[model samples]
Target: MTNEEFLSKMQDVLQTEEELKLDTVLDDLAEWDSLSVMATMAFLDKDFGVKTTMKDYKNVKTIGDIAQKAGL
Candidate 1:
């Protein structure tokens, strides 16, 4: 997917309205919780065929990190 599409999808995954840019910090968003992480995992797996576990989020600091994981 394109970076723009990835960012848009992440907004829905994260349930945030704060204009998610590639550099947006995941931890800074109020919607960035355990549930959001699970949603993200499911989204990535379903849309991009990228499997991820909870532990994988440990190093995820930015939206760009997720885009990388999604191979965007």
Candidate 2:
């Protein structure tokens, strides 16, 4: 998928109205909570066929990181 599509999906995953950029810090997002993590895990698996654990997020600091993981 393209980067724009990935970010659009992330907006849904995050349930946020704010626009997301590649460099947007995960920590800076109000929706960056446990629920969002779980949603993201499911999103990645369902959409990209990628599996991720909580440990994987330790190294993911931005929305771009998740896109990269999704192979975007």
Local distance difference test scores for all models: 0.92, 0.92
In angstroms, give how far residue 47 of model 1 lies from its true place.
Answer: 0.5
> How well is each residue in 1-72 modelled by candidate 2, as lDDT tens digits?
788888888999999898999899999999898999999999999998999999999889999999889988
Clashes of each: 0, 0
Q: Which candidate tops TM-score?
A: 1
Model 1 spans > 4 angstroms off: none
Ten residues in sequence with the least summed lDDT for candidate 1: 8-17
Model 1 pairs in collision: none
lDDT of the structure predicted as candidate 2: 0.92
Those runs of model 2 whose alpha carbons end farther than 4 Å from true positions after fitting are none
Candidate 1: lDDT over CA atoms? Answer: 0.92
- Model 1 error, position 42 (Å): 0.4
Model 1 quality (TM-score): 0.96
lDDT of 1 by residue, 1-72 (tens): 788888998898888889999998988999999999999999999999999999999999999999999988
Looking at model 2, which ten-residue stretch has the lowest summed lDDT? 1-10
